[model samples]
Target: MAIEIENKDQQHPRAKKDGEVVERLLQESANDNNLAEVARLRIRYGGFPGARSMQRNLDIVLERWNLTEEGLFELTRQIHAEGRAYKRNSNGEEQEDWT
Candidate 1:
């Protein structure tokens, strides 16, 4: 016999707010010049998954560009938001048109 699992229908209350935050962060990061510092701040406080992995990626990116904390929070915020978006879309939630 096969067992079927049902998915929940409730929408997360914070989804729209989170999306808005990510959009704002992306816009801010695009115009900021101190990306290196921003990367450092994200590594320190973004609470992203695989802390070591995020730090490593940040370090690699920093090697080629100068950055600062001025806009790192927004950058990291976008990174995490994108990750969430990918997971949600993959799981069959409404897919956002990133294009």
Candidate 2:
């Protein structure tokens, strides 16, 4: 599923750059087998209605990485059950560890 910006001229340069960064991070995390980070990224941007471009970029990343969102969530849930998952505080900051 290739996601191309419908109107390249209408998209802000910064947004495009940020999307690229997200793509890179997702790819790196996938390559490193960092399921936790991948899950984090999904939580951060999945279904984010505020940014259509980012959402499209995320879909592209998932397809390129050969990952399904459902599978990622299942693995993440298992990780959480094992007590090896990171938690986010009310401030949306990642805690050092679940402990």
Which regions of candidate 1 deviate over 4 angstroms? 7-10, 30-99
Ten residues in sequence with the least summed lDDT for candidate 1: 29-38
| Candidate achieving the largest TM-score | 2
Q: In terms of lDDT, which candidate is strongest?
A: 2
Off by over 4 Å in 2: 1-23, 29-33, 86-99
Model 1: lDDT equals 0.43
What is the per-residue lDDT of model 1 for residues 9-53, given as tens digits with 9 covering 90 to 100? 444344354444433444453333334233433444354433344
Q: In candidate 2, what are the lDDT values of residues 2-81, reduced to their tens digit?
A: 98866333443345555666767655646323566556656765554456767676677677667898977787788867
- The ten-residue window of minimal lDDT in model 2 covers 7-16
Clashing pairs in 1: 34-67, 34-68, 35-67, 36-67, 37-67, 37-68, 37-69, 38-68, 38-72
TM-scores of all candidate predictions against the true structure: 0.27, 0.49
lDDT of each: 0.43, 0.62
